[model samples]
Target chain A: MGRGMKRWMLWLPLAVFALLFAVVAAGLFRPADRTVRSAMIGKPIPNFTLPGMVPGKPGLATATLTAGRPHLVNVFASWCVPCIAEAPQLMRLKAMGVPIEGIAIRDTREDLLGFLRRNGDPYERIGDDQRSAVQVALGSSGVPESFVVDGAGTIVLQHVGDIRAEDVDDIAAAVRNAK
Target chain B: MAALCIALAAPVLADPSTPPAALAYTQLRDPAQEATAKALMETLRCLVCQGQSIADSDASLAGDMRSLVRERIAKGENPASIRAWLIQRYGDYVTYDPPLSAVTWPLWLAPIVLLAVGALLARQSFRRRPR
Candidate 1:
Protein backbone atom coordinates (compact mmCIF):
# COMPACT_ATOMS: atom_id res chain seq x y z
CA MET A 1 0.00 0.00 0.00
CA GLY A 2 1.16 3.55 -0.65
CA ARG A 3 2.27 5.56 2.44
CA GLY A 4 -0.64 8.05 2.16
CA MET A 5 -3.24 5.28 1.55
CA LYS A 6 -1.92 3.27 4.54
CA ARG A 7 -2.12 6.40 6.76
CA TRP A 8 -5.70 7.05 5.54
CA MET A 9 -6.66 3.39 6.33
CA LEU A 10 -5.20 3.76 9.86
CA TRP A 11 -7.64 6.69 10.56
CA LEU A 12 -10.64 4.90 9.02
CA PRO A 13 -11.88 3.45 12.35
CA LEU A 14 -11.77 6.89 14.01
CA ALA A 15 -13.46 8.49 11.02
CA VAL A 16 -16.22 5.84 11.13
CA PHE A 17 -16.67 6.34 14.88
CA ALA A 18 -16.93 10.13 14.47
CA LEU A 19 -19.48 9.76 11.67
CA LEU A 20 -21.55 7.31 13.74
CA PHE A 21 -21.35 9.61 16.77
CA ALA A 22 -22.49 12.60 14.71
CA VAL A 23 -25.53 10.71 13.40
CA VAL A 24 -26.47 9.39 16.88
CA ALA A 25 -25.93 12.75 18.58
CA ALA A 26 -28.03 14.53 16.00
CA GLY A 27 -30.81 12.01 16.54
CA LEU A 28 -30.50 12.34 20.31
CA PHE A 29 -30.70 16.13 20.27
CA ARG A 30 -33.32 16.54 17.57
CA PRO A 31 -35.44 13.43 18.00
CA ALA A 32 -37.64 12.01 15.25
CA ASP A 33 -41.09 13.64 15.03
CA ARG A 34 -43.21 11.47 17.31
CA THR A 35 -46.39 13.40 16.55
CA VAL A 36 -48.64 11.64 14.04
CA ARG A 37 -49.90 14.18 11.53
CA SER A 38 -53.36 12.92 10.64
CA ALA A 39 -53.76 11.80 7.04
CA MET A 40 -57.40 12.95 7.30
CA ILE A 41 -56.34 16.56 6.83
CA GLY A 42 -57.87 18.07 3.66
CA LYS A 43 -60.43 15.26 3.63
CA PRO A 44 -64.06 16.03 4.47
CA ILE A 45 -65.15 15.11 7.97
CA PRO A 46 -66.63 11.63 8.15
CA ASN A 47 -70.37 11.31 8.63
CA PHE A 48 -71.57 10.56 12.17
CA THR A 49 -73.98 11.97 14.76
CA LEU A 50 -72.56 11.74 18.26
CA PRO A 51 -75.03 12.17 21.14
CA GLY A 52 -74.49 15.15 23.39
CA MET A 53 -72.09 14.48 26.27
CA VAL A 54 -73.82 16.90 28.63
CA PRO A 55 -77.47 17.80 28.89
CA GLY A 56 -78.62 21.11 27.32
CA LYS A 57 -75.53 21.26 25.04
CA PRO A 58 -76.12 20.05 21.45
CA GLY A 59 -74.66 16.86 19.99
CA LEU A 60 -71.98 17.07 17.26
CA ALA A 61 -72.38 15.84 13.69
CA THR A 62 -70.76 16.27 10.27
CA ALA A 63 -73.73 18.35 9.10
CA THR A 64 -73.16 20.89 11.88
CA LEU A 65 -69.42 21.14 11.06
CA THR A 66 -70.10 22.02 7.46
CA ALA A 67 -72.75 24.60 8.39
CA GLY A 68 -71.38 27.56 6.40
CA ARG A 69 -68.70 28.60 8.92
CA PRO A 70 -65.24 27.61 10.08
CA HIS A 71 -64.88 26.04 13.51
CA LEU A 72 -62.54 24.09 15.83
CA VAL A 73 -63.08 20.46 16.84
CA ASN A 74 -61.20 19.58 20.00
CA VAL A 75 -60.75 15.94 21.03
CA PHE A 76 -60.38 15.75 24.77
CA ALA A 77 -61.14 13.64 27.85
CA SER A 78 -62.01 14.46 31.43
CA TRP A 79 -59.26 12.08 32.60
CA CYS A 80 -56.46 13.51 30.49
CA VAL A 81 -54.24 15.98 32.41
CA PRO A 82 -53.22 17.96 29.34
CA CYS A 83 -56.86 18.63 28.57
CA ILE A 84 -57.09 20.47 31.87
CA ALA A 85 -53.93 22.41 31.01
CA GLU A 86 -55.37 23.61 27.72
CA ALA A 87 -58.72 24.61 29.15
CA PRO A 88 -57.72 28.23 29.53
CA GLN A 89 -56.58 28.52 25.91
CA LEU A 90 -59.81 26.89 24.73
CA MET A 91 -61.76 29.45 26.75
CA ARG A 92 -59.63 32.21 25.26
CA LEU A 93 -60.36 30.94 21.77
CA LYS A 94 -64.05 30.83 22.60
CA ALA A 95 -63.83 34.38 23.86
CA MET A 96 -62.28 35.44 20.57
CA GLY A 97 -65.58 34.34 18.89
CA VAL A 98 -64.12 31.07 17.63
CA PRO A 99 -66.77 28.38 17.31
CA ILE A 100 -65.29 25.47 19.26
CA GLU A 101 -66.91 22.04 19.36
CA GLY A 102 -65.73 19.18 21.54
CA ILE A 103 -65.49 15.40 21.40
CA ALA A 104 -65.31 13.86 24.86
CA ILE A 105 -63.39 10.57 24.54
CA ARG A 106 -64.15 7.69 26.89
CA ASP A 107 -65.54 10.00 29.55
CA THR A 108 -68.60 9.49 31.68
CA ARG A 109 -71.52 11.93 31.85
CA GLU A 110 -70.78 12.77 35.49
CA ASP A 111 -67.08 13.22 34.80
CA LEU A 112 -67.84 15.34 31.78
CA LEU A 113 -70.10 17.56 33.86
CA GLY A 114 -67.44 17.87 36.55
CA PHE A 115 -64.69 18.65 33.99
CA LEU A 116 -66.82 21.38 32.42
CA ARG A 117 -67.70 22.85 35.82
CA ARG A 118 -64.06 22.93 36.96
CA ASN A 119 -62.80 24.34 33.65
CA GLY A 120 -65.33 26.73 32.20
CA ASP A 121 -67.20 25.21 29.25
CA PRO A 122 -65.94 26.71 25.98
CA TYR A 123 -67.75 24.22 23.76
CA GLU A 124 -70.94 25.06 21.89
CA ARG A 125 -71.61 21.41 21.05
CA ILE A 126 -70.02 18.52 22.95
CA GLY A 127 -70.13 14.99 21.54
CA ASP A 128 -69.66 11.85 23.57
CA ASP A 129 -67.10 9.60 21.85
CA GLN A 130 -67.70 6.84 24.40
CA ARG A 131 -65.84 4.23 22.30
CA SER A 132 -63.51 6.63 20.43
CA ALA A 133 -64.93 5.58 17.06
CA VAL A 134 -65.22 9.18 15.93
CA GLN A 135 -61.72 9.92 17.23
CA VAL A 136 -60.25 7.00 15.26
CA ALA A 137 -62.20 8.05 12.18
CA LEU A 138 -60.72 11.55 12.54
CA GLY A 139 -57.27 9.86 12.81
CA SER A 140 -56.74 11.34 16.28
CA SER A 141 -54.40 9.18 18.36
CA GLY A 142 -54.67 10.90 21.71
CA VAL A 143 -56.67 13.28 23.84
CA PRO A 144 -56.38 17.11 23.62
CA GLU A 145 -55.85 17.19 19.84
CA SER A 146 -57.59 19.91 17.86
CA PHE A 147 -58.47 20.35 14.21
CA VAL A 148 -59.55 23.39 12.27
CA VAL A 149 -62.46 22.61 9.97
CA ASP A 150 -63.58 24.88 7.15
CA GLY A 151 -67.14 25.68 6.05
CA ALA A 152 -66.86 22.96 3.42
CA GLY A 153 -66.27 20.39 6.24
CA THR A 154 -62.69 19.78 5.13
CA ILE A 155 -60.10 19.44 7.87
CA VAL A 156 -57.73 22.38 7.41
CA LEU A 157 -55.13 21.93 10.16
CA GLN A 158 -54.40 19.49 12.98
CA HIS A 159 -52.77 20.63 16.20
CA VAL A 160 -51.50 17.68 18.23
CA GLY A 161 -50.95 17.91 21.98
CA ASP A 162 -52.14 20.59 24.38
CA ILE A 163 -52.85 24.09 23.16
CA ARG A 164 -50.63 26.51 25.05
CA ALA A 165 -51.06 30.28 25.34
CA GLU A 166 -48.84 30.86 22.31
CA ASP A 167 -50.90 28.50 20.11
CA VAL A 168 -54.01 30.63 20.58
CA ASP A 169 -53.03 33.09 17.84
CA ASP A 170 -52.02 30.39 15.35
CA ILE A 171 -55.29 28.52 15.87
CA ALA A 172 -57.26 31.72 15.41
CA ALA A 173 -55.30 32.46 12.24
CA ALA A 174 -56.07 28.97 10.88
CA VAL A 175 -59.76 29.44 11.55
CA ARG A 176 -59.64 32.85 9.83
CA ASN A 177 -57.85 31.38 6.79
CA ALA A 178 -60.52 28.70 6.58
CA LYS A 179 -63.17 31.43 6.40
CA MET B 1 -38.84 -23.20 39.65
CA ALA B 2 -41.93 -25.38 40.02
CA ALA B 3 -43.90 -22.51 41.56
CA LEU B 4 -42.73 -20.07 38.88
CA CYS B 5 -43.75 -22.51 36.12
CA ILE B 6 -47.21 -22.85 37.67
CA ALA B 7 -47.57 -19.07 37.89
CA LEU B 8 -46.68 -18.73 34.21
CA ALA B 9 -49.10 -21.51 33.21
CA ALA B 10 -51.95 -20.36 35.44
CA PRO B 11 -53.84 -18.48 32.71
CA VAL B 12 -53.83 -21.47 30.38
CA LEU B 13 -55.07 -23.73 33.17
CA ALA B 14 -57.92 -21.38 34.13
CA ASP B 15 -61.53 -22.35 33.33
CA PRO B 16 -62.36 -21.95 29.63
CA SER B 17 -65.99 -21.06 30.50
CA THR B 18 -64.96 -17.72 31.99
CA PRO B 19 -66.50 -15.09 29.70
CA PRO B 20 -64.10 -12.68 27.99
CA ALA B 21 -63.77 -9.39 29.88
CA ALA B 22 -63.51 -6.95 26.97
CA LEU B 23 -65.53 -6.95 23.76
CA ALA B 24 -62.53 -5.96 21.69
CA TYR B 25 -60.20 -8.52 23.30
CA THR B 26 -62.50 -11.44 22.55
CA GLN B 27 -61.25 -13.81 19.84
CA LEU B 28 -63.49 -15.09 17.07
CA ARG B 29 -65.12 -18.51 17.61
CA ASP B 30 -63.91 -19.79 14.25
CA PRO B 31 -60.25 -20.81 14.61
CA ALA B 32 -59.41 -20.21 10.95
CA GLN B 33 -60.83 -16.69 10.92
CA GLU B 34 -59.21 -15.85 14.27
CA ALA B 35 -55.86 -17.09 12.94
CA THR B 36 -56.08 -14.78 9.93
CA ALA B 37 -57.03 -11.79 12.05
CA LYS B 38 -54.24 -12.52 14.56
CA ALA B 39 -51.67 -12.69 11.77
CA LEU B 40 -52.79 -9.32 10.42
CA MET B 41 -52.79 -7.81 13.92
CA GLU B 42 -49.17 -8.88 14.42
CA THR B 43 -48.20 -6.77 11.40
CA LEU B 44 -50.02 -3.63 12.62
CA ARG B 45 -48.22 -1.01 14.67
CA CYS B 46 -49.95 0.34 17.80
CA LEU B 47 -50.27 4.10 17.46
CA VAL B 48 -50.11 4.66 21.20
CA CYS B 49 -47.21 2.34 22.10
CA GLN B 50 -45.26 3.12 18.90
CA GLY B 51 -42.82 0.23 19.47
CA GLN B 52 -45.38 -2.59 19.85
CA SER B 53 -47.58 -4.21 17.21
CA ILE B 54 -51.34 -4.14 17.90
CA ALA B 55 -51.30 -7.91 18.64
CA ASP B 56 -48.57 -7.42 21.30
CA SER B 57 -49.96 -4.24 22.82
CA ASP B 58 -52.56 -3.93 25.58
CA ALA B 59 -53.39 -0.30 24.80
CA SER B 60 -57.09 0.42 24.37
CA LEU B 61 -56.49 1.74 20.85
CA ALA B 62 -54.79 -1.54 19.97
CA GLY B 63 -57.75 -3.44 21.38
CA ASP B 64 -60.10 -1.27 19.32
CA MET B 65 -57.97 -1.92 16.22
CA ARG B 66 -58.02 -5.64 16.98
CA SER B 67 -61.80 -5.55 17.26
CA LEU B 68 -62.09 -3.70 13.96
CA VAL B 69 -59.84 -6.27 12.26
CA ARG B 70 -61.73 -9.23 13.72
CA GLU B 71 -65.12 -7.78 12.82
CA ARG B 72 -63.96 -7.06 9.25
CA ILE B 73 -62.45 -10.54 8.86
CA ALA B 74 -65.70 -12.11 10.06
CA LYS B 75 -67.50 -10.11 7.37
CA GLY B 76 -65.33 -11.92 4.74
CA GLU B 77 -63.14 -8.90 4.05
CA ASN B 78 -59.56 -9.76 3.06
CA PRO B 79 -56.60 -8.61 5.17
CA ALA B 80 -55.24 -6.40 2.36
CA SER B 81 -58.45 -4.37 2.16
CA ILE B 82 -58.61 -4.01 5.92
CA ARG B 83 -54.99 -2.87 6.02
CA ALA B 84 -55.72 -0.39 3.27
CA TRP B 85 -58.66 1.04 5.25
CA LEU B 86 -56.48 1.59 8.34
CA ILE B 87 -53.63 3.05 6.25
CA GLN B 88 -56.06 5.46 4.69
CA ARG B 89 -57.18 6.83 8.04
CA TYR B 90 -53.98 6.60 10.12
CA GLY B 91 -51.39 6.86 7.34
CA ASP B 92 -48.66 4.28 6.55
CA TYR B 93 -47.32 4.45 10.12
CA VAL B 94 -49.94 1.93 11.28
CA THR B 95 -48.39 -0.91 9.27
CA TYR B 96 -45.17 -2.78 10.08
CA ASP B 97 -44.76 -3.65 6.40
CA PRO B 98 -44.27 -0.30 4.68
CA PRO B 99 -44.88 -0.20 0.94
CA LEU B 100 -42.26 1.25 -1.41
CA SER B 101 -42.73 5.01 -1.80
CA ALA B 102 -40.69 8.03 -2.88
CA VAL B 103 -39.45 8.56 0.70
CA THR B 104 -39.06 4.88 1.69
CA TRP B 105 -37.17 3.50 -1.36
CA PRO B 106 -33.89 4.39 0.34
CA LEU B 107 -34.73 2.25 3.40
CA TRP B 108 -35.23 -0.81 1.16
CA LEU B 109 -31.99 -0.19 -0.77
CA ALA B 110 -29.63 0.65 2.14
CA PRO B 111 -28.88 -2.94 3.22
CA ILE B 112 -27.95 -4.14 -0.30
CA VAL B 113 -25.84 -1.03 -0.93
CA LEU B 114 -23.99 -1.45 2.38
CA LEU B 115 -23.25 -5.13 1.67
CA ALA B 116 -21.93 -4.35 -1.83
CA VAL B 117 -19.61 -1.63 -0.46
CA GLY B 118 -18.36 -3.97 2.29
CA ALA B 119 -17.60 -6.72 -0.27
CA LEU B 120 -15.71 -4.31 -2.55
CA LEU B 121 -13.63 -3.00 0.37
CA ALA B 122 -12.88 -6.57 1.48
CA ARG B 123 -11.66 -7.46 -2.05
CA GLN B 124 -9.41 -4.36 -2.18
CA SER B 125 -7.93 -5.15 1.29
CA PHE B 126 -7.26 -8.80 0.29
CA ARG B 127 -5.45 -7.73 -2.93
CA ARG B 128 -3.27 -5.24 -0.98
CA ARG B 129 -2.18 -7.79 1.69
CA PRO B 130 1.49 -8.95 1.58
CA ARG B 131 1.75 -12.60 0.52
Candidate 2:
Protein backbone atom coordinates (compact mmCIF):
# COMPACT_ATOMS: atom_id res chain seq x y z
CA MET A 1 0.00 0.00 0.00
CA GLY A 2 1.09 3.57 -0.70
CA ARG A 3 1.89 5.99 2.18
CA GLY A 4 -1.42 7.84 1.47
CA MET A 5 -3.38 4.54 1.61
CA LYS A 6 -1.66 3.59 4.88
CA ARG A 7 -2.59 7.00 6.36
CA TRP A 8 -6.27 6.52 5.17
CA MET A 9 -6.52 3.06 6.79
CA LEU A 10 -5.33 4.43 10.16
CA TRP A 11 -7.92 7.25 9.99
CA LEU A 12 -10.72 4.82 8.88
CA PRO A 13 -10.65 2.82 12.13
CA LEU A 14 -10.41 5.99 14.17
CA ALA A 15 -13.44 7.41 12.36
CA VAL A 16 -15.39 4.17 12.92
CA PHE A 17 -14.49 4.12 16.63
CA ALA A 18 -15.53 7.78 16.98
CA LEU A 19 -18.88 7.06 15.28
CA LEU A 20 -19.49 4.07 17.54
CA PHE A 21 -18.62 6.11 20.63
CA ALA A 22 -21.01 8.87 19.57
CA VAL A 23 -23.87 6.40 19.10
CA VAL A 24 -23.24 4.78 22.48
CA ALA A 25 -23.02 8.18 24.16
CA ALA A 26 -26.29 9.24 22.59
CA GLY A 27 -27.97 6.06 23.81
CA LEU A 28 -26.62 6.51 27.32
CA PHE A 29 -27.17 10.27 27.78
CA ARG A 30 -30.24 11.14 25.69
CA PRO A 31 -32.38 13.76 27.40
CA ALA A 32 -34.59 12.22 30.11
CA ASP A 33 -37.05 15.12 29.70
CA ARG A 34 -37.96 14.16 26.11
CA THR A 35 -38.37 10.48 26.92
CA VAL A 36 -40.65 10.94 29.96
CA ARG A 37 -42.34 14.29 29.25
CA SER A 38 -45.44 12.87 27.54
CA ALA A 39 -46.19 10.40 30.32
CA MET A 40 -45.36 12.53 33.34
CA ILE A 41 -46.60 16.05 32.68
CA GLY A 42 -49.74 17.55 31.13
CA LYS A 43 -50.95 14.40 29.36
CA PRO A 44 -54.64 13.49 29.46
CA ILE A 45 -55.57 10.57 31.67
CA PRO A 46 -55.91 7.25 29.83
CA ASN A 47 -59.48 6.40 28.80
CA PHE A 48 -60.47 2.78 29.46
CA THR A 49 -63.49 0.80 30.70
CA LEU A 50 -62.46 -2.81 31.13
CA PRO A 51 -64.32 -5.76 32.65
CA GLY A 52 -63.73 -6.49 36.31
CA MET A 53 -62.10 -9.72 37.55
CA VAL A 54 -65.47 -10.86 38.85
CA PRO A 55 -67.85 -12.12 36.20
CA GLY A 56 -71.05 -10.36 37.26
CA LYS A 57 -69.88 -7.42 39.36
CA PRO A 58 -69.53 -4.01 37.72
CA GLY A 59 -65.85 -3.55 36.82
CA LEU A 60 -64.05 -0.25 37.25
CA ALA A 61 -64.43 2.14 34.36
CA THR A 62 -62.34 5.16 33.35
CA ALA A 63 -65.59 7.10 32.97
CA THR A 64 -65.97 6.67 36.74
CA LEU A 65 -62.51 8.28 37.18
CA THR A 66 -63.17 11.94 36.49
CA ALA A 67 -61.39 15.30 36.54
CA GLY A 68 -63.77 16.36 39.31
CA ARG A 69 -61.52 14.97 42.09
CA PRO A 70 -57.84 14.16 42.50
CA HIS A 71 -57.15 10.43 42.26
CA LEU A 72 -54.24 8.02 41.89
CA VAL A 73 -54.15 5.34 39.22
CA ASN A 74 -51.82 2.36 39.57
CA VAL A 75 -50.82 0.07 36.69
CA PHE A 76 -49.78 -3.37 37.90
CA ALA A 77 -49.62 -6.99 36.77
CA SER A 78 -49.71 -10.29 38.66
CA TRP A 79 -46.56 -11.51 36.93
CA CYS A 80 -44.54 -8.45 37.92
CA VAL A 81 -42.53 -9.16 41.08
CA PRO A 82 -42.09 -5.44 41.86
CA CYS A 83 -45.87 -5.04 41.93
CA ILE A 84 -45.92 -7.51 44.83
CA ALA A 85 -43.26 -5.47 46.61
CA GLU A 86 -45.41 -2.32 46.29
CA ALA A 87 -48.64 -4.01 47.47
CA PRO A 88 -48.11 -3.15 51.15
CA GLN A 89 -47.29 0.44 50.25
CA LEU A 90 -50.52 0.61 48.27
CA MET A 91 -52.40 -0.73 51.28
CA ARG A 92 -50.77 1.96 53.40
CA LEU A 93 -51.95 4.58 50.88
CA LYS A 94 -55.47 3.14 51.25
CA ALA A 95 -55.16 3.28 55.03
CA MET A 96 -54.28 6.95 54.65
CA GLY A 97 -57.61 7.35 52.78
CA VAL A 98 -56.12 8.01 49.37
CA PRO A 99 -58.41 7.25 46.46
CA ILE A 100 -56.54 4.68 44.37
CA GLU A 101 -57.71 3.03 41.17
CA GLY A 102 -55.88 0.16 39.52
CA ILE A 103 -55.26 -0.89 35.90
CA ALA A 104 -54.29 -4.59 35.72
CA ILE A 105 -52.42 -5.17 32.46
CA ARG A 106 -52.10 -8.47 30.57
CA ASP A 107 -52.97 -10.71 33.51
CA THR A 108 -55.48 -13.52 33.88
CA ARG A 109 -58.56 -13.22 36.15
CA GLU A 110 -57.32 -16.02 38.41
CA ASP A 111 -53.88 -14.42 38.84
CA LEU A 112 -55.36 -10.99 39.57
CA LEU A 113 -57.82 -12.36 42.08
CA GLY A 114 -55.00 -14.33 43.65
CA PHE A 115 -52.89 -11.16 43.92
CA LEU A 116 -55.76 -9.19 45.51
CA ARG A 117 -56.49 -12.01 47.94
CA ARG A 118 -52.83 -12.33 48.95
CA ASN A 119 -52.28 -8.58 49.22
CA GLY A 120 -55.17 -6.61 50.70
CA ASP A 121 -57.18 -4.80 48.05
CA PRO A 122 -56.21 -1.12 48.20
CA TYR A 123 -57.94 -0.23 44.94
CA GLU A 124 -61.33 1.47 45.13
CA ARG A 125 -61.97 -0.03 41.69
CA ILE A 126 -59.83 -2.02 39.26
CA GLY A 127 -59.78 -2.26 35.45
CA ASP A 128 -58.80 -5.52 33.69
CA ASP A 129 -56.56 -4.62 30.74
CA GLN A 130 -55.56 -7.87 29.05
CA ARG A 131 -54.61 -6.30 25.70
CA SER A 132 -52.71 -3.31 27.15
CA ALA A 133 -54.89 -0.79 25.30
CA VAL A 134 -54.85 1.44 28.37
CA GLN A 135 -51.08 1.00 28.63
CA VAL A 136 -50.65 2.13 25.02
CA ALA A 137 -52.97 5.07 25.67
CA LEU A 138 -50.95 6.00 28.74
CA GLY A 139 -47.64 5.56 26.80
CA SER A 140 -46.29 3.27 29.51
CA SER A 141 -42.99 1.49 28.83
CA GLY A 142 -43.72 -1.06 31.57
CA VAL A 143 -45.31 -1.72 34.91
CA PRO A 144 -45.63 -0.93 37.74
CA GLU A 145 -46.42 2.71 36.84
CA SER A 146 -48.60 5.09 38.80
CA PHE A 147 -50.25 8.31 37.66
CA VAL A 148 -51.64 11.16 39.68
CA VAL A 149 -54.60 12.73 37.94
CA ASP A 150 -55.80 16.19 38.69
CA GLY A 151 -59.43 17.29 39.15
CA ALA A 152 -59.39 18.30 35.48
CA GLY A 153 -58.46 14.72 34.52
CA THR A 154 -54.94 15.71 33.44
CA ILE A 155 -52.15 13.36 34.41
CA VAL A 156 -49.94 15.60 36.53
CA LEU A 157 -47.32 13.14 37.75
CA GLN A 158 -46.15 9.60 37.04
CA HIS A 159 -44.05 7.11 38.99
CA VAL A 160 -42.34 4.36 37.00
CA GLY A 161 -41.19 2.02 39.76
CA ASP A 162 -42.43 0.60 43.08
CA ILE A 163 -43.68 3.21 45.51
CA ARG A 164 -41.71 3.59 48.71
CA ALA A 165 -42.58 5.41 51.95
CA GLU A 166 -40.65 8.53 50.80
CA ASP A 167 -42.68 8.65 47.58
CA VAL A 168 -45.92 8.76 49.60
CA ASP A 169 -45.32 12.38 50.61
CA ASP A 170 -44.58 13.45 47.00
CA ILE A 171 -47.70 11.69 45.71
CA ALA A 172 -49.82 13.23 48.50
CA ALA A 173 -48.40 16.65 47.67
CA ALA A 174 -49.28 16.15 43.98
CA VAL A 175 -52.79 15.03 44.96
CA ARG A 176 -53.17 18.11 47.17
CA ASN A 177 -51.87 20.34 44.41
CA ALA A 178 -54.22 18.70 41.92
CA LYS A 179 -57.16 19.35 44.18
CA MET B 1 -28.47 -21.93 1.89
CA ALA B 2 -31.40 -23.35 -0.08
CA ALA B 3 -32.63 -25.29 2.97
CA LEU B 4 -32.25 -22.11 5.06
CA CYS B 5 -34.24 -20.12 2.48
CA ILE B 6 -37.00 -22.77 2.64
CA ALA B 7 -37.03 -22.72 6.47
CA LEU B 8 -37.06 -18.94 6.50
CA ALA B 9 -39.91 -18.82 4.01
CA ALA B 10 -41.90 -21.58 5.79
CA PRO B 11 -43.33 -19.53 8.66
CA VAL B 12 -44.23 -16.64 6.37
CA LEU B 13 -46.08 -18.87 3.88
CA ALA B 14 -48.10 -20.88 6.40
CA ASP B 15 -49.32 -20.84 9.98
CA PRO B 16 -46.44 -21.56 12.42
CA SER B 17 -48.28 -24.62 13.81
CA THR B 18 -48.55 -26.15 10.33
CA PRO B 19 -45.41 -27.68 8.82
CA PRO B 20 -44.45 -26.23 5.46
CA ALA B 21 -45.50 -28.43 2.50
CA ALA B 22 -41.98 -28.19 1.07
CA LEU B 23 -40.44 -29.25 4.38
CA ALA B 24 -42.85 -32.22 4.60
CA TYR B 25 -40.97 -33.90 1.73
CA THR B 26 -37.61 -33.62 3.48
CA GLN B 27 -36.18 -36.59 5.44
CA LEU B 28 -34.47 -34.25 7.97
CA ARG B 29 -37.77 -33.71 9.83
CA ASP B 30 -36.58 -34.08 13.42
CA PRO B 31 -38.79 -32.77 16.25
CA ALA B 32 -35.83 -32.62 18.67
CA GLN B 33 -33.92 -30.42 16.21
CA GLU B 34 -36.98 -28.15 15.82
CA ALA B 35 -37.26 -27.73 19.60
CA THR B 36 -33.56 -26.99 19.87
CA ALA B 37 -33.89 -24.35 17.11
CA LYS B 38 -36.80 -22.67 18.92
CA ALA B 39 -34.94 -22.72 22.24
CA LEU B 40 -31.79 -21.21 20.71
CA MET B 41 -33.79 -18.46 19.02
CA GLU B 42 -35.53 -17.63 22.29
CA THR B 43 -32.17 -17.41 24.08
CA LEU B 44 -30.46 -15.29 21.37
CA ARG B 45 -30.59 -11.51 21.21
CA CYS B 46 -32.02 -9.44 18.35
CA LEU B 47 -29.37 -6.78 17.83
CA VAL B 48 -31.81 -4.42 16.13
CA CYS B 49 -34.44 -4.61 18.85
CA GLN B 50 -32.16 -4.48 21.88
CA GLY B 51 -34.96 -5.28 24.32
CA GLN B 52 -36.35 -8.25 22.37
CA SER B 53 -35.12 -11.83 22.12
CA ILE B 54 -34.45 -13.17 18.57
CA ALA B 55 -37.60 -15.35 18.84
CA ASP B 56 -39.75 -12.32 19.77
CA SER B 57 -38.38 -9.70 17.38
CA ASP B 58 -39.69 -9.15 13.85
CA ALA B 59 -36.38 -7.64 12.68
CA SER B 60 -34.50 -9.08 9.68
CA LEU B 61 -31.43 -9.72 11.86
CA ALA B 62 -33.67 -11.70 14.21
CA GLY B 63 -34.85 -13.76 11.23
CA ASP B 64 -31.21 -14.37 10.25
CA MET B 65 -30.37 -15.45 13.81
CA ARG B 66 -33.41 -17.78 13.81
CA SER B 67 -32.25 -19.31 10.49
CA LEU B 68 -28.71 -19.67 11.82
CA VAL B 69 -29.97 -21.35 14.99
CA ARG B 70 -32.14 -23.73 12.92
CA GLU B 71 -29.15 -24.68 10.73
CA ARG B 72 -26.96 -25.37 13.79
CA ILE B 73 -29.68 -27.45 15.46
CA ALA B 74 -30.18 -29.41 12.22
CA LYS B 75 -26.43 -30.09 12.19
CA GLY B 76 -26.92 -32.03 15.50
CA GLU B 77 -25.40 -29.34 17.71
CA ASN B 78 -26.76 -29.34 21.28
CA PRO B 79 -28.53 -26.14 22.39
CA ALA B 80 -26.15 -25.65 25.35
CA SER B 81 -23.08 -25.98 23.12
CA ILE B 82 -24.59 -23.66 20.54
CA ARG B 83 -25.30 -21.10 23.29
CA ALA B 84 -21.73 -21.45 24.51
CA TRP B 85 -20.47 -20.87 20.97
CA LEU B 86 -22.56 -17.68 20.66
CA ILE B 87 -21.37 -16.45 24.07
CA GLN B 88 -17.81 -16.93 22.86
CA ARG B 89 -18.47 -15.16 19.55
CA TYR B 90 -20.46 -12.17 20.87
CA GLY B 91 -19.57 -12.24 24.55
CA ASP B 92 -22.43 -11.95 27.12
CA TYR B 93 -23.95 -9.03 25.15
CA VAL B 94 -25.98 -11.66 23.21
CA THR B 95 -27.77 -12.59 26.46
CA TYR B 96 -30.20 -10.08 27.98
CA ASP B 97 -29.46 -11.20 31.53
CA PRO B 98 -25.71 -11.73 31.64
CA PRO B 99 -24.26 -13.63 34.60
CA LEU B 100 -22.71 -11.47 37.29
CA SER B 101 -18.93 -11.91 37.23
CA ALA B 102 -15.63 -10.03 36.74
CA VAL B 103 -16.60 -9.44 33.07
CA THR B 104 -19.74 -7.55 34.20
CA TRP B 105 -17.95 -5.45 36.87
CA PRO B 106 -17.72 -2.34 34.67
CA LEU B 107 -21.43 -2.50 33.78
CA TRP B 108 -22.35 -2.80 37.47
CA LEU B 109 -19.89 -0.28 38.91
CA ALA B 110 -19.05 2.29 36.18
CA PRO B 111 -21.92 4.63 37.09
CA ILE B 112 -21.05 4.86 40.82
CA VAL B 113 -17.34 5.22 40.13
CA LEU B 114 -18.00 7.84 37.45
CA LEU B 115 -20.18 9.83 39.82
CA ALA B 116 -17.62 9.65 42.61
CA VAL B 117 -14.75 10.70 40.34
CA GLY B 118 -16.84 13.48 38.84
CA ALA B 119 -17.68 14.78 42.32
CA LEU B 120 -14.06 14.71 43.42
CA LEU B 121 -12.82 16.36 40.20
CA ALA B 122 -15.56 18.98 40.38
CA ARG B 123 -14.56 19.81 43.96
CA GLN B 124 -10.87 20.04 43.10
CA SER B 125 -11.28 22.04 39.88
CA PHE B 126 -13.90 24.38 41.32
CA ARG B 127 -11.80 25.02 44.44
CA ARG B 128 -8.74 25.97 42.33
CA ARG B 129 -10.60 27.85 39.54
CA PRO B 130 -12.75 30.06 41.83
CA ARG B 131 -15.97 29.19 39.99
- Name the best candidate (by TM-score): 1
| Tens digit per residue, CA lDDT, model 2, A85-130 | 8899888887777889888876777877887889878887788765
Instruction: Tell me the interface RMSD of model 2, in angstroms.
Output: 14.9
RMSD of 1: 7.7
Q: How high is the lDDT of residue A177 in model 1?
A: 90
Misplaced by over 4 Å in model 1 are A1-11, B1-23, B115-131
B119: Cα error in model 2, Å: 45
Global lDDT scores for all candidate models: 0.88, 0.70
Q: What is the TM-score of chain B in candidate 1?
A: 0.72
The CA lDDT at A65 in model 2 is: 62
Which lDDT value does model 2 have at A167? 89
